[model samples]
Target: MAGVLTGVVGALLTLLLHGAQHVVFGAGGHSFAQEVRLASPPRRLIGMTVAGAVIGLGWWQLRVRMRVIRVRDALGDPPVRLPLRSTTLDAIAQIIAVGAGASLGREGAPRQVAAAVAEVLCARLGLDDRHRRLLLGAAAGAGLAAVYNAPVAGVLFAAEVVLGTLDYIAVCAAALMSCIAVVVAWPVVGRDAVYHLGAHATAPNVWVWVVLAGPVCTVAGIGFNRLMEAARRGGPSRAIHLLPLRITAAMAAVGLVAMTLPGVTGNGKSVLEALVGRGGLPAGVLFALLVAKPLLTAACLRGGLTGGLITPSMATGGALGALVALGLGHDQGGLSMVVCAMVGAAAMLATTQHAPIMAGAFMLEVSQAPPTLWLPVALSVAGAWATPRLATGLKQL
Candidate 1:
């Protein structure tokens, strides 16, 4: 029951996201980045500025009225009951912000909404705290599955990240919820992979390259995570009365940046797609994105924005991978740019999220990469996951 409701709400959230994008950026059938690229400079500037004003005022009002409990806090030991109304409103605001060119991921909104729905249902059913936690975690994962059509990744996310458990019962529940949500969402969201990759044979020596590159990607991922933490810490406080004006100015600055680099606007999906697609960006542009995307994303968070880091992290990783491929002379013919980017994405994602299996499954499910690439991806993810811990241990020693 929770799964079904979450799927429905998740699909509605997806529609709302698309509608917001269309309304904000005049995005007709194309991706958000493309629409931003196609828009006139004035339009880009005006659109983001207006969006920032509206979001700032709206969130200011909402935050002043009630304390918003994050999904993580709601899922704590006692399992606090989520306020459905506030959570739904928060989700809508997040969607609007992202649609209007915020450098944050849209996945967080659906997860929050789904968890709220599960909380409501648990109350009505009088479920125990344990059962409620399990259902809430599953629902959150199901929401991710619905949006991306990734059941396996959803299950892994629930078990590894949300619940922090690998118990057989929890895994089974997560799998069932994720599978149902994906099936339910197929009609509205489509069943195709979220990303399309061109046909490119894997380079024979890709494994060797991945083994060497994984640690580098992990270091980059660690840096990205620290930057985000710093941004969150330094962001404007809710007590500020001038939040709306401040946010508007910050978003305007983002618009100015987007005027030249439209790819930095959205959650970074289009950037990732471009990286893995045929005729990827030039080496210089890739390097620029590797530096700019994360910095811009961190800036948004510092400006009081709230959203997921998954896609942004993946995109940054893709840029790093592409750059590494170029540096290692694999871009010529040895390793395809597509494969290198995927390895980088997986490694970075694993490092940032601290979940190797989930990260690998997500990259594979979203890209529909062939099974032959699995071993190399696993090795890369393992290296990424282990490197930071080893470094920490060495420091302690």
Candidate 2:
């Protein structure tokens, strides 16, 4: 039952996002939210600010009626009954924000919606806390799988990260639900690789460069988290807890930044796709985006807009990798760049989410890289995971 509901909602969210993009940007096909852009800065600024304000207002109202519980909260904590009405509202708000180019990912909305469905069903079925929690994790992961078309990664994310431990039953349930969700979603959203990077060969020449990219991705991931924390801390005080003011200010800042560095806006999926298709970008441009995207993302999220950072992080990590490849003068046909992209994205995602296995699976699945590259990518993720632990320990001493 949870699997069916998750699949249905996931498919609907996919269609809704694509439809919104079509209407807003006059785009012909399924387009990433970031690709739906206005031609002029002034228009984009207005669109972003108003969209942020509306999202803020909607969330403020929803909070008054019922506190929205995050998927992470249900993963490790007591099973709190999720209210359907508030959950729906939160999903709608996220859709609107991303559809309007608010610099956020659309995946989070569907995950929350799926969790709500599971919660409602589990509560009525009189399931115990453990069962309810597991189902919620499974549904959330299934939703992610539906969106990204990554069933294995989704199962791992649920079983390994969300549940924190995996048993035979847990693994079976997660994998089953994720596969079902993807199957249901495939008709509405064609099974397309998120980023089609032709084909990747193991770049022996770039192996050292990929290794070097591991630490760079680690630093960037840590810095991204810190910026987000700082902005989160800085926001409420500045706005006196006023949601509209907070969102407006933060989104306005994003808009102004977008005026010059337009690449910094949106989830960065389309931008990443373009980079892959075109092989590589200028190192200077990649560097600027690498630095600015985290700051902009922090601003939007910290200012009270609800969205996921995973896609944005992936995009930024890919760009960072391309930049490194540029320095190595190995950016040909984007093969080397794509290799670096996989490594950096895996490292950053593993560090940020604390799910190295999921990170490796996701990067490989989405990039469609040759199996030979997976070991290097996994090793890079391990380094990324270890770096922070060592730093924190040294700091504690």
Which candidate leads the pack in lDDT?
A: 1
| TM-score on alpha carbons, each prediction | 0.95, 0.90
lDDT of 1: 0.84
Pairs of colliding residues, candidate 1: none
Q: Tell me how far the alpha carbon of residue 38 in candidate 1 is from the true structure, in angstroms, after superposition.
A: 1.5
Writing each residue's lDDT as its tens digit, candidate 1 over 1-397 gives 7778778877887888888778767865567767777788888888899999999899888888877888899888564678999999989988888888888888899899989998989899998999889989998888888888999999999999999999998999999988888888777888887888875556666656689657887888889999999988866564457778867876787788888777788788888888776457778788778888898889888877788899999999988877777776665322377788888999999988889999999999998888877877888898987787888999999
Candidate 2, poorest ten consecutive residues by summed lDDT: 30-39
When summed lDDT is taken over every stretch of 10 residues in candidate 1, the lowest stretch is 326-335
Candidate 1: which stretches are off by over 4 Å?
Answer: 77-79, 236-238, 330-335, 392-397
- Give candidate 2 regions above 4 Å deviation: 28-30, 199-202, 234-241, 388-397
- lDDT for each residue of candidate 2 in 324-381, tens digit (9 for 90 to 100): 7676777544576777777777787876777878888898887675677778787888
